[model samples]
Target: MKQQIPLYLGIDGGGTKCKARLEDAQGNLLGEGLAGPANPVRGLALSQQAVLDSTLMALEQAKLGQGQLPSVNACLGLAGVNVALYANQYKNWRHPFAKLHVMSDLQAACLGAHGNQDGAVIICGTGFNAGAYINGQLTEVGGHGFELGDHASGARLGINAVRRVLEAIDGLCQHSSMTKAITSYTKCSNASALFETYHKATPSQFAALAPIVIQYAKQGDVHAVEIMRTCAAYIDLVVERLQKLCPPRFSMIGGIAEPMFQWLNKASQDALVDPLHSPEEGAILFARNNEH
Candidate 1:
């Protein structure tokens, strides 16, 4: 009887989207797929669906049928799995793969950025977080979710922009560039529309406003300048905390990384480095290293 070929799956499950890659035993690349957000906090059903959707797409690209799922070992690095309760809840969740290991998205990003070497990554997409892998030790900061934390994140910036707009309406703050920009973006000509738009907005929807803020700031808008200043300060705080565990060598990842990079001070900018591999590739490395 011939032995079956082994397959591995690596997933980067972020707050905004889930990405997956498939590889054979010898570390050769196979296929890749993408799906919606897989943050467990977003809801177990949605997360599971995203994981399945992305993994199935990957398998399809590899010319493998659904039956092959039972032969594949997988590592899922997901956002919102950092919370102990969510981790515990999702750890026992059903999946199609033969083996599955769940960890934080930041962990996957860090591993991907450094290729499992000692280094760190600051992720600033719809959410913010820093992960460090040093001396075989792992540490993470931020990623407290949209409600309590995620300072310097796209979502946070968007939220701040809206707040300033409201303040301006109330005659509390000057109607600076961001206020005009957000109001235009939201199409909220009146106070009621402004309230209605934000009240119904999602994190991704809010994050969409961040680029507008960036646009205005580049044109030297007063409010836009202050927003970036505050944003940089938050990112600086996160880096300072991570520095205690690892060196300043950092690769900034995610949708907002580039804009944030430009706003960061020269010292912080100096610390930024290029990633050796992508998060999905890092997930593959994680799968390769852990074979129980």
Candidate 2:
């Protein structure tokens, strides 16, 4: 009798986007996919659809059919999975796969960064989140969502940048390079107009401005520097807390990580490490070890 080929699926689901990767037993990459936001905290229905859509895209790229899903061991690392309410609700939630593992995106990043070894990861992306893996325990901080927390996240940085620009216009704070950059980016005549236009902007839209802030900071813009510094401080706090729980091997992950890391203190920089693999690989690692 011939042995069947083994396959695995790994998913990194976040507030901004969902990513999926398919690989054979030997860990050679087969295919990958991307979809919309998959943060369950925002809406479980949307999250479920995003996950399914991205996974199917990967399977299609791998020239596999839906029937193959039941045979493929899968792991999903999702944002908002750290919330007890969401985690509890989704733990027993139905999925298409025969075997599946679910964890927070931060946890997946940690596993990916350290390759299942003891370490920590701070995700400073569209949303902020941190996690540490020590021995067998996984602990997380932040990532409560924009309205609640996510202090060091891209969304937050953008929001702060906008606020500073508005203050600058009102003569409440120093007007610097960010004022012009933010005004141009928002395409608003003035700070008040920007505020009005962005009163209901989406997370992705707000996060879009973070790069502008970082750019100005790179040019020695006073307001931009302060904003970046503030973000760095928030990240530093999370790293400090995680280090207290786990080894100091920290990897900064996500869109804003590099810019933010540049502002961290020397001690924090000393503890920094590079990730061994992507979060998708971490999901594969989880699937390999946890498949039923």
Candidate 3:
């Protein structure tokens, strides 16, 4: 029988979604797939299922079947794995791939952004995190999770907007168009209603309100402007911290990266460059380098 060609899979799993890229040993792209959230911090079972679902989708797109899974090497860059507990949990999963390597999504983004060269990346989506690669060492900052940190994140923006709306409804603060808009969006005209609606909301649910805040800020609403400015200031500080590493390249990525760019300080703005590749591609690089 002819020897089957080696296959590689790169998985980028985050709070919102999981993406997979399939490639042959020669670096030729074969297929790609996307699925729902795979952040193990939220739920290890859900994350594992998402990983398998996305990988299967990629395999199907490549004209392969489940049997081929045993021939594939995979590198998974996942959110929440930065924590030792979550990392250990994921490493212990009985996955089907021939080989599996797990790493933090921030590290994967940095690798992808610089095409494996030394660089840095800041991710600003439902959550926030920053990582830098310098002189073969990988250093990370922030990403403590929603409750403790995640400064300048979409979830933070949403939470602040809701708080402001509640304050306005209670007459503690003057209402602006932004506040009114938020109340309307939540369908909560009174403070009690607002509290009930979001009291048990998840990070993604809160993050859903981020666009409303950005829109109202663009329209010059005082509350919105203040919220955006505060978030921007936090990002500025993160940039300053990362700058100490002096990475050869720096990039900001995630759902809010572009929308929030104008609000950032000039120094933070000047530090960014376009990423050379997507995080999934970076995962592929990792799989290739680490394959035994």
Winning model by lDDT: 3
Question: Which stretches of candidate 3 lie above 4 Å from their native place?
Answer: 1-4
Please give, for residues 39-79, the per-residue lDDT of candidate 2 as tens digits.
88878988889888998898888878777877778889999
For candidate 2, give the lDDT. Answer: 0.85
In candidate 3, the residue pairs with backbone N, CA or C atoms under 3 Å apart (3 or more residues apart, or in different chains) clash, namely none
lDDT of each: 0.84, 0.85, 0.90
TM-score of each: 0.92, 0.92, 0.95
* Candidate 3 lDDT, 200-244, residue by residue in tens: 887788899999999999999999999999999998998999998
The runs of at least 3 residues in candidate 1 whose Cα sits more than 4 Å from the true structure, single-residue gaps closed, are: 1-4
Query: Residue 103 CA error for candidate 1 (Å)?
Result: 0.7
lDDT tens digits by residue: candidate 1, 1-292: 2215678899998777899999999888888999998888878888889999999999888888788988888998888888998899887887778888888888888888887888888888888878788877778877799888888788888888888788889898789867886888889966788889887676787898998888888888887888888989888877777767756358889888987788887767877798888887888788878877
What's the true lDDT of residue 84 in model 1?
95
By TM-score, the better pick of 1 and 3 is 3
Candidate 1 Cα lDDT to native = 0.84
